[model samples]
Target: MSFNFYKWLQEQDDIIKKGVLFICDSLFVDCNFKGYYIEDNNLIGNVLAPQYETLKQYKELNPYTNTEHIRYFFELTKAGIKHVATVLSYERSKDTMQVCLEEQYEYITIENGVVEMTNFEPLTVLIKEKFKL
Candidate 1:
């Protein structure tokens, strides 16, 4: 997570940099909120949430300048942000690393139907039950 966070920092736009920095700090250092709890302690939770005031502040801002993780990057700064909060699996095979938001009210689910045509990776989803806050 540290490596990925550092990589993202160097590549992100200057405007979004602060939001990205805050998220990185919260995730890698000061985690003050609980988003969710999962099996084996794997947590996928909220990292940032947009405020009505911030919405006005960002309304005049330009769109993200890059495409990598583009959808999430913008969502994090101007709207609601969610992420993989923690992974406590020991065997390395006990992590699900995902949460479906199809019925969740806090999220706006986008189904482009593009990835539906891809093949399966024979991966393991070990969580017996997923909990959201």
Candidate 2:
């Protein structure tokens, strides 16, 4: 039987997806911070909002102030970039990687003596074969 690597990887636990996004974002940030030109800084965040939301909620519930930001920080380190590259290699070798878009929005309203409106475009997964990394 021919194995479908992309499907298999997608079926892996949510950690895999989260880890991938985190690493991607970290790498982008590191590159930009080092004065490298980046086309879109929000690309990773937009694609991975769902996963990020999950991780954020998890941290929020746990509520440890100092450690709480660790996840965010992790997504922007050299180690994070290396990890992302590794995962992408695995994903590409299997030929089951694609870029997806997730449309996200925030409401503008007045609350707690402040008015705010924000919009987010998150990254997502699509059913396809291979991505240029």
Candidate 3:
């Protein structure tokens, strides 16, 4: 199964989709994903992206949220990227990984916040070009 952004996104719950949008928005604002992935499931004091300084504050701001749940989705996205790179024989590096995520986010933006593919070329083509596949 190849990576299909819209299909993968449709499988997520609403909260997780919102979390991903938050991540994309953060990246768009500052081009930084410094602490998006959480290894220990500890987001309370951890700086997750630039906008939300801490998960505690994020929760306070957005009451109907589970930080851990959102973190899980974040990890899933990261793992999916790693899997794509491996399957496509692309060298896994920080820069390349960031590019993959950025391109996907840009695709979402181009779709007017929808997870459809309309304005851009097939995602595989863009990613293949990056990987030289």
Candidate 1 regions with alpha-carbon error over 4 angstroms: 1-61, 70-113, 117-127, 131-133
How far does residue 40 in candidate 1 sit from its true spot (Å)? Answer: 31
Error of 3 at 91 (Å): 32
Candidate order by decreasing TM-score: 3, 2, 1
Q: Model 2 lDDT vs. the true structure?
A: 0.26
lDDT of 2 by residue, 2-105 (tens): 12422343344244445445434532433111111111222344333113333334334434322201111122234243211111213223322222211221
For model 3, where is the 10-residue window of minimal lDDT? 85-94
Instruction: Evaluate model 3: give its lDDT.
Output: 0.30
> How does each model score on TM-score?
0.17, 0.18, 0.24
Cα lDDT over the full model 1: 0.24
RMSD of 3: 14.6
Better TM-score candidate (2, 3): 3
Report, for every candidate in turn, its global Cα lDDT versus the true structure: 0.24, 0.26, 0.30
Give, for candidate 2, the lowest lDDT window spanning 10 residues. 119-128
lDDT of 3 by residue, 1-133 (tens): 1123223323432433344445344333211223223222333575533344344444455554322222222222321343121101111111111123333522222223333222222334434444344
